[model samples]
Target: MNDQPILLILMIAVGLYTFNLWREDCKNAQAGKPSPSALPGATPASAKACIIAALGALVILIAETWGELRLGLSDQQSKITVLFGIYTLIAAFIEELIFRGFIVIENKGRALRWAGVAMASVLFAALHPFLWKWEDGVFAWTFSAKGWFSTAAVFASSLWFYTVRFASFNPHRSLLPCIVAHATKNMGVILIKGAQGFVVGLF
Candidate 1:
């Protein structure tokens, strides 16, 4: 256990969240629709959504990995990256499928989907050790007031955008947006950190 306690715990939290969502996915599949692995053919609307999501992800990755803000492979840093990456990918897929796809479908109205997003955004903040970096993170956990303002900022902004993006298109099509937002958020953080380091190096 050479890793940081907070980071480790957060990783576990993400795992639990993802696992719970995966189980729900299994239940959804039992009904009729296919799972993420065997998702049916993409409709024209969904295909477009996917392309937009892919492009956004690409832009974020490029900004981080290519710019002066690139990350280093220090032991602790690498560990955090690997754990976060794995969790992010898993959580994004699971969370999106449940919150956006399944819940929206089962609820029969906007109420359920809105509730899901609210719940997801709140939970998403809790799962973060550095919640202060998002938007609503401040309201999620009070004991740790560290960077709470910043975290809240990101959460609100991201959620606002996420809601709008999801509303503009169908879940079958908007799944990509959620996936992209998750990936892009990770990449965006990395880029900011990288840029900071680059600036520091020049000082």
Candidate 2:
């Protein structure tokens, strides 16, 4: 079975989920009870935070991909560059909405919020199917060393995004920083992989 269709369906699902969040926020605003954390507009401080988060994410991506860069590249080109790009952006937005926007925003008090963050981070990591492999059209759990490492890396990345989502001291919470950071990380990975492909082609 081709994984591309599965990925496309997942992307659409995520997009719909994000759209529902936006719709709900709009409805709440029209009802004269605006949500404080309703995807607030980015302020100057948030913009700075976004830059910081993006840089941090980029550093992480570089570190993680360094081995891949050093290794001999594959001559085969990526067929899903455009699909992957769109998917990454949509996935990042969906993750922010589910983990940071809904979970963190709905939970009250510091303790609850932190708990929510932890739960969401774990869920976020687990939801990433890329860490595992599918065999004979069935999902398989190898629990290999690489799988564990990938899952851990994903968990850490999710935690970083969550931190950025609520890093602002402002009253309103903006997910812009987290989204920017996530997108930066994804783009960095894509660029590195593309470079690897180019290097391989030269061989």
Reference-based TM-score, model 1: 0.47
lDDT of each: 0.49, 0.65
Q: Write model 2 residue lDDT over 83-132, tens digit each, in one string.
A: 55556667777777667666664547877877877888888888876455
Which pairs of residues clash in candidate 2, taking residues 3 or more apart in a chain or in different chains? none
Best by TM-score: 2
Q: What is the C-alpha lDDT profile of model 1 across 1-203, one tens digit per residue?
A: 22344665576586677556555554565566646663321122355565566555555445434432233322112223434444555555555555444544333577876676677666655555544233333444334333353345445544643553555554444355555556555655555455444212211
In terms of lDDT, the poorest run of 10 residues in model 1 is 71-80
Provide TM-scores for the models: 0.47, 0.69
